[model samples]
Target chain A: MRVPEVLLDVRDLRICYETSRGCVKAVDGVSLEVYAGETFCLVGETGCGKSTLALAIPRLLPPNARILSGSILFKGVDLLRVSDSKLQELRGKEIAMIFQNPMTSLNPVHRVGFQVAEVPVTHFKMSWREALATAVRQLGRVGIADPDLRSRDYPHTFSGGMKQRSMIAMMTTCKPSLLIADEPTTALDVTIQAQILKLLHELKNEYGLTLLLITHNFGIVAEVCDRVGVMYAGKIVEVADVTEVFEAPLHPYTKGLIDCVVARRKSKSRLNQIPGTPPSLLNPPTGCRFHPRCAYVTHECVKEEPRLIEVRKNHLVACHNYEKVGGVSWSS
Target chain B: MELLVVEDLRKYFEFKKGLFARKQYVRAVDGVSFSVERGTTLGVVGESGSGKTTLGLTILRLIEPTSGRILFNGSDVTRLSKEELKHFRRSTGIVFQDPYSSLNPRMRVKEILERPLKIHSDEGEESRVERIIKTLEEVGLSAEHLMRYPHELSGGQQQRVAIARAIILKPLLVVLDEPTSSLDVSVQAQILNLLLDLQSRHELTYVFITHDLLTAKHVSDFIMVMYLGKVVEYSTVREVFSNPRHPYTASLLSSIPIPDPKLRGRKRVSVVGEPPSPLNPPKGCRYHPRCPYAIDTCELREPELLEHDKKHFVACHRAGELSFREFLADMDSFLSE
Candidate 1:
């Protein structure tokens, strides 16, 4: 099978928030790429800058957050340098994002159909009637039965799963080249979460859309992602194939995250838990953000930050002792 | 031996719709019954609005049960008077889902920990502080943390402080309402491990209420699956996981995503449609609307929870007839389509 072409490219992105407690380095020097039809996942714990990195792609960061450096290239156009009018034109047409909480993202007073069709009408200059028709079809595509009737109902009328499905329908109604889904299934139950993930995978294939899936659940990343990027303290520490990351995680943070998840198949004597909390973003540890909690921390790990170095064919790890870190090998 | 026995427990909240209109009864805990043995964890798993939290609260008599018997130590605490209930509350403590909200923001960790000890025991203030410090250590918090308020700590640290306060009273039964749900995965493991250690050390009984099956399976000796205010299935963790008798139980287990991508295409039972409202539940079985094998009998009469094995009890009319493997295979095809 031929690989899809790259659609969006992010280079050395840096984002900082001006808060009372000092400038919070939210997304610090992060870079990633999204292929035309591939699912590239950003996996990390909360406050690891996965969401910040995602929001930066569409230039949707709050007023307090400013992009200190870097370029976001979509079809060779730097999104960071684009004017507000141009960025607005590119938002729902070239890129769309699905937020974590669907309830809050949706307008409470407006009908579901109106909220969904707002983008198509505003961006594409389509008639209200024509946009509503398209929105109905989009709802049906996301597996909501009786879309025509349900579209007229309010957000409160729908259940959690239905709300999430409606959110997906609204996000993908324009058929943007890249879809950034930020923890879309975290608020849902296991069964509903499974259905949503399956739906997302189906939608990705049917629309031939590239995806940037953000989640804290490793299980979700393993299931949906083709390539995975593990972030820590606003930096991509490890990037590799899904199978490689799961089978042989290189970074200490990634390893600890994998260990923390309770696998359905693994029957262990005791669950392995990583000790200590993630460092604060305001004053993140000097050299390596993960050095404080890393089990194999060396003197060099504290003095200088490690860069992403190719360890194997397609695996990149940012650890000083990638060659010597012991335990379960990733070759299996 | 049964340390606490709940027989046909029910809690209903009556809402006055209008001045002269009829009232509406919200059946939060509808005729649920289960027993907890000494030194064991009974995990109650369900989705939101499934009455798992209300059941936990009702057992402790924090909220009075509409109708039922909560027999602890062979004494029916459900029927106890307000003053008498205080004695029962002393033996039972609750840790809520959100530690930040549950703990008072204004109070320091030391005050929160000492309140329970001061209320339940007649110990002097100086000795109580020492005991509070010891409890903090047990939950993996330090005495330095005692002076800090809930806002000063992270989510995990606040949860640890909550655990210290709950276990400081040495309650025989502790109702943990999603104790580790709000914390991060790594911190969740630490909290769960602490709970396990404390349970074994004190020989305490725990009613762990959560929607997370993996965590439930990790800590619980026995697992109970609830749907629309009903206990659909209750069994040993190993037996329930390996060979789920009830269709609902089987579907819940299969729905959980395993970390391995190779198993992504594995067969799983997927229950379609949302659970019916508790205000007007289904006629016979609450799960019949979502069950794959719902038949005429299932709609006509509710199946009583019967023991298929030594300790496994399932409440499905077609439990013996339905094959979980075949159902899962069918669901996989249906879902993929």
Candidate 2:
């Protein structure tokens, strides 16, 4: 398969929030690229700053979050330096986002059809009548039953699955080049989650849209993503092809996460849990953020941070003891 | 011997539409029956509106059940007086899904643990404090954590504190409603292991309620699958996984995504359409609308749960004729190889 052209290029992205205690380094020095028609997944635990890095790509951070340094270049235009009006034009047209919670993100007072039509009417300058028709078509496209009748209903009338489909329809109606889905199926049940995931896969192929999926569920990453980046303490500790990362995870943190999940899944006995918790972002460890809980931790691990080094053609690892810690190879 | 027995449990909430209007009853948990043996786990699996939580709550009498018999150690506590009910509740505790919200935000961990002991027993405060510290240690928290509030702890630690409180009273049964659903996988493992260890140590019977099939399989000795406030299937964990009788159970097990990437594109039965509303369930078999093997007779009569084998019960009329063994064999092949 030929690699699609790179549509969004993020380099050295750093974001910090001004808190009373100190400056919380939410996203620190993250760099990656999303190809034109591929799914790039950011997999990590809660509070790992994957969401913050995603928000930084679209310049959607709040007023208090300072982008300390870095550049988000999308289609040759630096999103950090774009004018407010130009950014507004690019938001819904060039890039669209689907948030974690669809209920809160959707406008409660408006009808579902009008809320979905809001994006196309505002961005493409389509008339209300035209946008309404387009919105109904998009709803039907997402496998929503009786779109015409249901479109007139409010968000409360729709089930969790339908509301999610509406959210997806709203995000994709404009046919944006890239879609950012941050935990889109977290609020849904397994059955509904499967449906939504299948819908996203079909839509991505149908529309030829690049996808940036941020989720903590590794199972989802394995199913949907082409390439995966494992984040820890606001940094991309490992980045590789989806199969390679799952099969041959190199970083200690990635290995721990995989082991933790795999162990719990296989044994009817007690799960082999990873000791300790994720470090606080406000005062991260001196060197590697994962060094505190790493089983193969060494003095060097605490003294010098490991740079992401290519261990294979496409696999990267950011651990000092990657070559030596060899009881169980992640790559089966 | 039956450690906990619930027969024909029903909990309905009445809503009035107008000042002079008739009342509308929301049948949250309508006529559910099951029993748990001593030192065993009975898992209740269902969808969001399937009333699994309401059933657990009703069993504990946290909310009054409209009519039922909750026999704990051969004593029916449903009709107990307020004083007797308070005493009965101390012997049967509950752990909620969200640990952060369940624990009082303003109270320290120590106080949270001690409040239960203070209410139920006449033990001195000093001894209760020691018991609290010991229980905290058992759940993997330290005495240092005693001074921390719920906000200061991580999700896992707060859940541990919640478990410590539930077990401090030495309850005969603990009703865990999706206890680990809100937690990360690693933290979920820790909490689950803790629960198992505590169960063995205390010889406690547990009614674990969750929609997660994997967790249910790992924790429960017996599993009951519910749909639209009805028990569709009930059997041993091994039997349910190896030979699921009901169509709903088969669909649910197949819907769960195995963590392994090698088994990604395997073929399995996937149930289509969402669950029907409980307010107005379908005629006859509530599951016939989605059942792939539905016959005309299914829509005309509801199937009663019958004993297909010793300790295995199924409610589908065609469950005996269905080839559940073939389905399990296919799933095992996909998962294993």
Candidate 3:
């Protein structure tokens, strides 16, 4: 088998936020690699730092957040060392991100057409007329009927699904190699979510895009992701092929997360819940952040943090008792 | 015996564009009717703008219904006197979708749970504290949380506090409106399990309203599918899952991304286009514009909700004639392939 080229390589990235109480370690020494032309999903509960990691890839961390130590290599270029102009040149042209709420992301005062046209105009330096023309066609390409009329309307006139489509259209105007979608479909309805996800998959195929999808919903991961990384308390616990992640989850948190999704199977049995809440990032636990909630925690788990290690080819797990989690008796 | 019954409940809000402009009606809850058994849950499933929330609120008289009636234990809630309505409100409770907003951030957990008791009961301060502690324990919270404010608690704990407040009065029925939608998946499971445990222990009837079909199926005995302020399909959970008569229901079922990765490419019905504006909904079948199997009659004539099979109600022009079984079977075959 041919080895896939690495598109985005993140190494030992640590991110923290300055707060009144203390420094909140949002992403603590996490490392992962995304391959070209493949969908990599970072799945976790809220506040697990998946979104922060995604934002960190394109150097989009807010002012309050600081990168304690890390290197983000995109196409063999370390973004952290890049100059402001160089990073700005690479931002929307090569790396684009879509947030959870398109309503908030899109400017309410500007027409949808003008907002989309601004992308090509700013990045490629196209003329206003040419950019406007391109925007209409781009809107049509993203399944917006009558792009001419719809493009003239403001964000308020568009529905939630349409607003999302416009966001996708604007993001893909440059056809970036890497698209970081942070819970892109979390706000839409089920049917509309299906539509948006299908649109994303098609766009990925059309553009040969490498997708970094950050989501809490496993269903979306099952639908689109080629590989999966399960995050817990700002640390990655497991990374594996999508199929293996479901069929044979090595980490206890991964197992608990999969079992927690109320599956389609109609049964009265109770869902398997991870005991205790996630540790506050201000001052994490003594050792493993998940030891308090893990069902298979041992003395070793509490004393030291487990490192992500390759237990099998292309599959990794960070758990003291991963061997005990092998037997697949998944209720769902 | 039916514990709660809503008969043709309707809630319409009027919007006037100008002083002389005609007052247009936004039928938020056009007409919805359902009943719940004493110990069972009726899951009200729909997307946004489908009026499921309005229906829940109207049933509790939190949002007064413009028309129709709500009967609790054979007593008409709409006709109740001011004193009787106050008495009736104590037996019914509602937990909103967003716990962070539903809870008063200024109030501590003890005061939050105590507010309902102080208003509804004449118990002494000592007895109320005892009751508060017991109720907190029931929702898996402890005395430590009592003194903490809402912001100090996590999302799941805030929801548990909301649930505790809803049940502290020991109401016979509780309307859980998307209680777990805002929570993380693991925390969602914890809250769902807690709710089920509470229901069985207290014999409480729940009107569980949510947009998630999987959660609705998991917690509900009967499922009611809504679209544009109307019930498109209603049946026992088993019947709704196995033989969905309404095209919208079938589309909704097929649209859910089954968590199993193996079922990725399974056949599904993509209801083309989004739901039309509720202010000016489609003339005939509300779902006709998006229904894949929409026929000419579906656009010309509105269909009444009729019973197609024992205990299965569907509002569609071609409910019985359309073979959703064949469509669903095709999906099942592809899923198992």
Candidate 4:
């Protein structure tokens, strides 16, 4: 089988947020790629800049955020170099993003149907009536019962799952090629979360869309993601096939992270914690950001930044002690 | 030897629609019966509206139970008056979720931990300060943290302070409501380890409540699964996880991704649709509408929580007949399709 073609590629992306103190280096020289029609996940802890890197793809950075230098190559077009009008057109037509919490992302006062309808109306210049009709149909596709009636309901009237469904409907209305869902099921229950995951999978297949899923939940990454990218302090630490990464995690942070989840364990033992906290991006540690917290800290690891080196086929890890960090078997 | 026995406990809230309209009763915790053995952990797992929080609060008498007896050491807590409860507070402790909101933002850590000791015990100022420092040390903090405010500490530190306060009194029972849910995964593991350590040291019984099944399985000796204000399945952690008895339990277990790529294509029960409203819940089995193996009997009659084995309990009409493997197959097909 031939290697799949790359859809979105980021090269030397750096993002900084202006605060009262100084510039917080959120995304520091991060680079990764998303293949067409594949679910690629970026897993990291909170404030690790995975979300910032995601938002930067569609130029959805906040007012205080500044993109110092990067080229977001989407279908061979540098999204950063694209015109403002072109980026706006690119947002809903080719790339769309879902947030961690749809409660804040969605307009509470507006009817859910109107929000979904606005996507097509603004993107395709459809009439209000035509868009509403299309929005209702899309809502039904997401498994929200009584699409016509539920579409008329406001965000406040819907459950966490329903609100996410409406958001999914709005995002995928135009069949955007890349769907960036950031913690889509974090606020939802396990049962409802399964349904949402199923809906996302179904929609991904139906639209033949490449999905960039950002989440901290390893369970979600295993279930839906085709490939995985481990992000730590704004850098892509490891990138590999989901199975390869889970079975034999290369980076110390990746191994420590996968070992943290309770479900992934083979035996009942104390969870292996990544000691210390995620470093403050305002003034991160030199060499490797994760070296301070990593269990296997070497002299060079603390002095020299390890490049993302591929030790195995299709598996990349950024760790001076990648070979030392042995594979932990998850199969019990 | 049970430390606490909750017999057919019920807690309901009345909401009046209009000035003269009939007040609707929302049955939050309906006839839940369970026991907490001394020095053991009982985890209550459920969705947001599944009454897990309400059950915890009611156990602490934070909310008045509609009807039931809460026996603590053979003393009825529900019957305890306001004056008598002052002494009772020494025996029970309650730690809420969301440490940011739970800890008083204005108060210092020393003040927060001191108030419980002063109220529950007769410790002087010097002894109180010493006790505070000792308790903080137990939760992996130090004396320096006492001077800082809640905002000064990280999310994990604030939670440690919260846990410190809960155990300072050395209460026989501490009702911890989703203590680890809000923390980062790494921090969450530390907190879980701390709780287990504190439990062993203090000889405490914990009512660990959370929505995450994995966390629940890790910390709990006995797990009580709640649904729509009712106990659907209550059993040992091994039974609930390895061989779930109730349809809801099996569905919930399968729905959770096993966090292994090898188990990616594996089948899991596909439970769709939202849980029914607690206000006007279904007449018979509240879960029948969403339960895949729902039969006429499930809809017609409410199944009692029956004992399958010595410790395993399930409330399902077709618990014996409906093979659990079939449920896993249903979920596998749900994914394959």
Candidate 5:
């Protein structure tokens, strides 16, 4: 068996925001590894810290946010300890990130092609003329029809799907190995979303990219992820192969989420919903953050946090009562 | 019996191309017609610029239609006078897509739900309070939430308050426009189940407008597919999912990403491009540019919606000649080594 090379390894990452009320633990002690040329997904609800953990890898947290502890090693180099100028050199050329909203990400005043060309020009010190040529080719490759004419057009003229395609074209200009897409298709329509997902899949294969896809939608996870990580509050509760995560989810939180999506396909039966809202991150629940909503909650879950432990081959679950949790088989 | 029937409804918003160019009409709801039965849901599924929300609002008379008849309970709602329209609105309700923006942050839950009652009813204050309490309980909220402001409630609880406000008058028809799109799956499931339970208990006719296919399939008895402000296909939910005739409908059904890795590994039939702009929609069929099976005739002439099978209507030039399921099956096998 060929041993997969580790591309990005994050260990014990604890990110927090110093607000007026208190310090909000956005991502608390998250440790995961992204293998080379594999798509790893972080699936969770809103404010679950999946985005925080992803942003921290690029060292792109907001001003108020701080990484209290942990190390982010990309290709055996510590990204957290790197100099600001060194990080900037590596940002667009080696590690790139795309945001959820395409409208705000690109400057509305500039032509779309110029913005895309700026990536290579700034990162690699390429000539503007050559980079612009590359920009047009990349635009065409991203499925933009009439690239020559559309490339000259402003961002406002591009549709939502077109803008996202342009964003992808711009991001891939440097041919970055690790692409962190945070809710890439959340703003698109269903058909357009399908088109973008297909484009991302094609690009992943063509570039041999290591993708860290963050989304709340399970369907996207099932569609693209090779492995899945189920995050709650600020910690990952379960990590497994894509099929195992769906077929035999060990954690109760993971089971509840899968059941929510699958039960809808079986006609008008009452949907099984997880009771209670996600706890506030200001003072996240003492022990397991999901224990308040977990069905198999016990006293151990309330008093102590369970570290991620391998319950089976390559299947890790962070729950004290994995033995008690029911298996969730895929119905369809 | 049909609780709500719309005939040849049209809404056109006029805007100038440039500063001095002649005014052109954006045919938002160019020509739409459908009916909701007494106690069943009619799901309106479409992408953006499809005018599903416009149709919903036009039915409620929030936006006056340019032409056509809106018959609610056997009366032309468009012809009603101002006072008569006020009375007509009491029989209908609407829930918007975002609960965060829909509910005023400053107002307490009690005041937000109480506004609808005050506008429609002339009952005493004591009775109005009693009705509000009862409606809150029905939507799974207790009296504790009544005094709390909208910001203090969670998204699911806020949506429940929105539902409670919509049904507080005991309206017969409710238009829910993407009510659960902004929620988590678990919370979304709770809201959907609550809607279904409320629907059966109150015998409410619903026009559920959403872009989520799974949620639509769960709650709707009938599904309506719209493109560029026109109904492309209309049929029972079973028929639409099982044997879709229109290329657009087939593309929609095929585009839905099912939550299974095995199916994901199999080939998916993705429609090629983005939807065209509403202002400059294609001449013949709006979906022809993106459809996989578009022929020369599809670009030249529009197809009228006609019954291809029993109780299933489709607007396509080649509705029955091509089998979409066979196409998908062939694609799946053809792509897999």
Candidate 6:
């Protein structure tokens, strides 16, 4: 019944990557808000700029990626306008990120304990011994059995699930108020995936930490996320409560994506597939980026881009014909 | 008549230590047994290191098995001579998960498809070229793609080319190892539908290996759930999904995040921890360490795979102790949330 406090506000974010094939508009004119203590999910298929937007928040873009225009406001301060020194102070302290590939993100040459310890060691300027001790404790919290001994092992020796736990432990070393986990469980097995999801859910509630999860798996979205944002062609096409999105998807892209998964499926016939592959961000379609594959495309939809408008209470969609295309009735 | 049958196949790799140190053996595919009749698919589903991929490779004899027999059309492949093996392999094809890596970048799509024909068939230049063109068309690719290298094609197109290469030989059995995992869902749907159509038309038996339970259920006539190199449960797609007998299979099924938001709050058994180290898989039942319903006897003795229902086999010590309905109900409860 009440609007939650916005912890991170991304307004008019536009990011482009300088590639030899020309500039790619990776994150184009995106605006979003993450409220405090809510596990928000940004779900999309590959190459939809979900990762790009996540990296933009911490100004962790690669060398070729440039923030064309945007402001990432975190707790009333523009993360983009902040000085490098200020960002350094904020990163891994007030906000932490857990990447999809922990093996690459972690320093392989070092022990898992030492790598996780690096977070606290550098941020708090704690002694190596003190940090290592804290790392063991954090690893234990994330359910790494025998954390005391396992912490001494190399990350390469750890399984995918263990490596993920170590990454989660490392990310939370500073006890950040917000955590951004990007496809953390995508590479894991279903059983191991369930464990990781449970751990993440437990950690989110225990620490009262706001989470920004990026994944393409609708199952993971329903399992852990509270609010969901559907992404297509570097644009947010729909945003709603997780229940609202799955129960009644307003955007055609959102409807098509949910229809493709087998779990929530109703028909035994061929899946309701979206007609074409995702549009190339290098030269995206005019007006609505999803119009090329949209089932309810129209003259108005092709001429002008639509903005997020609330058709139902707290449910926002960016499609011109939400009423016509939102006829996606789920058995649930 | 069975198209392919694997009898208790075991493939192990020995890691040599120092002269004084003992050798360590990794049983990548241990005591796995299954069979598929003509025009049917046997889906092998498992998590990483569960040997699902290794099992696929072993069936194709890409890797030598440590023991057991691979019977193809009632003939033992393990006993085949090198020359006989070469000829025998012509009827079997395998499509890997990463299409980009599997396809040769140096060769054009034409050469890739032609090489198979050159090795297996004695068809002359004209017919070979014609076959190559036809194969490309069969996979929904036009002749225009013949000259292009793998790098020139998109992921979906490259995968189509890989599929084309696999079926170009007109193999009796095609092993699809996580074929659609790397592609997007829309592309995945197309590839799956194509595979299904091809299977029915060509009467090809498939060994579909993947970690996705949903896809396994959809594309398979029968399903085999493997964990740590051993089969935990094997049954018809409907039975395995609806009435899973093994705790591991039940846990695996429940773990798949049902895509409905309303089901989010539903009860689901959350497997507590990861599988133990393969080298030290728990003493008795491999799944006992993580099984929520694990009992004391489970830790002392392993459960043999038994027929719990018609054609449904499960390996769980408590299979008789606990009804699958109750086990499934308990599995549906979320431990953390």
Clashes (backbone N, CA, C under 3 Å), per candidate, total: 0, 1, 0, 1, 0, 6
Off by over 4 Å in 2: A1-4, A262-267, A325-332, B324-337
TM-score of 5: 0.97
Question: Per-residue lDDT for A88-158 in model 5, tens only?
Answer: 98898889888899999989999999999999999988999999999999999999999989999999999
Report iRMS values in order.
5.9, 3.2, 3.4, 5.3, 5.3, 4.9
Q: Over all chains combined, what TM-score does candidate 2 have?
A: 0.96
Query: Which pairs clash inside model 5?
Result: none
Note the B-chain TM-score for every model. 0.94, 0.96, 0.97, 0.95, 0.95, 0.95
* lDDT tens digits by residue: candidate 2, A1-332: 77668899998889999999999999998888777888999999888999999888778899999999999889989999999999999898889999888899888999999998999999989999999999999999998889998899999988888888999999999889999999999988887888899899999999989999999987788778899999998999999988777767788778777766632344346666778889999999988889998888999999999988888787777888888644333221
Those runs of model 5 whose alpha carbons end farther than 4 Å from true positions after fitting are A262-264, A329-332, B327-337
**In model 4, which runs have C-alpha deviations exceeding 4 angstroms?**
A264-268, A329-331, B325-337
- Provide the global lDDT of candidate 5 against the true structure: 0.89
- Candidate 2 residue pairs in clash (backbone atoms < 3 Å): A247-A331
Better of 4 and 5 by TM-score: 5
My TM-score estimates for the predictions, one after another, are: 0.96, 0.96, 0.98, 0.96, 0.97, 0.95
lDDT of 1 at B309: 82
Go through the candidates in order and give each one's C-alpha lDDT: 0.85, 0.86, 0.90, 0.88, 0.89, 0.86
lDDT of 1 by residue, A202-223 (tens): 9899888898999888878877
- DockQ scores for all the models shown? 0.47, 0.46, 0.59, 0.50, 0.55, 0.51
**Top-scoring candidate (TM-score):** 3
> What tens-digit string does per-residue lDDT give for candidate 4 at A246-312?
8899998888877777765432356777777788888999998898898889899789999998889
Weakest ten-residue segment in model 6 chain A by summed lDDT: A262-271
Q: DockQ: which candidate is best?
A: 3
lDDT of 3 at B37: 92
Candidate 1 lDDT, tens digit per residue, B169-277?
A: 7889999999988888788877887888898889989999999887787788888999888888898887777777888888887877667666677777878877777
